[model samples]
Target: MAYQLPALPYDYTALEPAISKTTLEFHHDKHHASYVSKYNAAVEGTDFDKMAIEDVIKSIAGDPSKSGLFNNAAQAWNHSFYWNSMKPGGGGMPTGALASKLNADFGSYDKFVEAFKAAGGGQFGSGWAWLVVDGGTLKVTKTGNAENPLHLGQTPLLTMDVWEHAYYLDYQNKRPDYIAEFLGKLVNWDFAAANFAAA
Candidate 1:
């Protein structure tokens, strides 16, 4: 099956005045769409054509010849997760089970935020910050380029795209500010809870 862009749960400007509508349009419509399109093209006529995007990414591993496929497929999955990761009036703190897990894993929500922000901000280039379920514990990690938690046998519960295309139009070169705003005011814990439940 072909991967497609997932619709934003809220309006493009819903994330403003943190993330701009212009950035959302380009990031969702152009960047994410390009990944889906490229993934489809790469898989066409191959045995991997019928594989799920996640499976395709795993199948490709890190082989350079398959890098394009891996990048696009992982990106296709990543962007879909990223879209649902935020919503109107989202952010603050986790509650219920997610809260318990966060505390157990990172000791406190504040610590989690710091680690996530540091990972997102410290990424050398285009990348992502991820909260993943690993070996029955929640952990935070960063992935370069189109890499994702799937490669590490972990389930991504939430992610923040740190790629320049994700924040450039809105935050310019201040990627740290972008990460701060996302964690403080735009993280969709409700969506993340659902992902946790599913995972």
Candidate 2:
């Protein structure tokens, strides 16, 4: 079956102020939908069509001939993850095992915030910033266009889409402001905690 665009868990206006309705509509309905369509087209009638999205991504990552397939597939997967990475009323400090893990790995919540925001801000261009478990340690990392932690043998716990389309309609040229809101007001700690436990 062809991969389909997943609906946002919340309403278009649910993430307002942090993520505007207009931005959500365009980002989800246009940009993300495009990636899903392209990915389906790329994988149609191919062996990848029979594999899970993650499996396809891992199998073809870094192969020059499969770059197109990888790009669309990764973006499709990334956007799906990105939507759940935030919630209507989320952000601030995390709690439970995930909070403890962040504190242990990064020294404190503030330090973890610094590292995660830095990863998102420091990304040179269209890409993603991730909180991933690498070799059993929590880490902050960034990837250039269409790449993600899965390609690096890491398990992703959370993600922030740093692509221009993700924030341009809302924050304009002020990406730092967008990143700040994403952390202070929009990030979903519950989702991260669940991913952490699973990892």
Candidate 3:
């Protein structure tokens, strides 16, 4: 089946104050929807037409001839994952097994936050910062443009979109403030835990 835009788990205004409703509306409805549309168009009549979004991304990634398809398909998948990475009242550290793993892998929750923020903030251009399971070990990584951990044989446990469209309207040019809100008040730890458990 063709790739499609995934619905947000919460209402657009649900993340307000930290993230404005206007930002969600434009980001989800406009930005994400556009990626899905372009991705579908790119795969039309091709072998990727019926492939899963993740499969399509992996298949196209690094193939110069399919760069456009890779960009759109990866963006479509990334945005869907990004939506689930947050919730209205989420964030402020994880717990249980996931919490233990974070401490084991990154020293402590505060250290994880510092590393995550640094990864997100250090992304020089449109990109993402991710916490992923690479070869059964938790690692923090960053990818430029539409790149994601999946393409590198890693399992993404959590991600933060550093693209200007993700925070420009809400935090203006202060990407660090936006990153702080996402980590301090918006991250969906349950979702991360779920991803972690599955990984």
Kindly list the per-residue Cα lDDT of model 1 for residues 75-193, writing each as its tens digit. 88999999888877778899999999999889999999888988998899889999999988899999998899897899998899998899888788999888888888889998888
The window of 10 residues in a row where model 3 has the poorest summed lDDT is 51-60
Better of 1 and 3 by lDDT: 3
Ranked by lDDT, top first: 2, 3, 1
lDDT of each: 0.87, 0.94, 0.91
User: For model 1, what is the C-alpha lDDT against the true structure?
Assistant: 0.87
lDDT of 3: 0.91
Candidate 2: tens digits of C-alpha lDDT, residues 76-137 = 99999999999988989999999998999999999999998899999998999999999999
Show where candidate 3 strays beyond 4 Å. none
Report the alpha-carbon TM-score of model 2 versus the true structure: 0.99
Error (Å) of candidate 1 at residue 7 is 2.0
Question: Of the pair 1 and 3, which is ahead by TM-score?
Answer: 3
Clashing pairs in 2: none
Off by more than 4 A, model 2: none
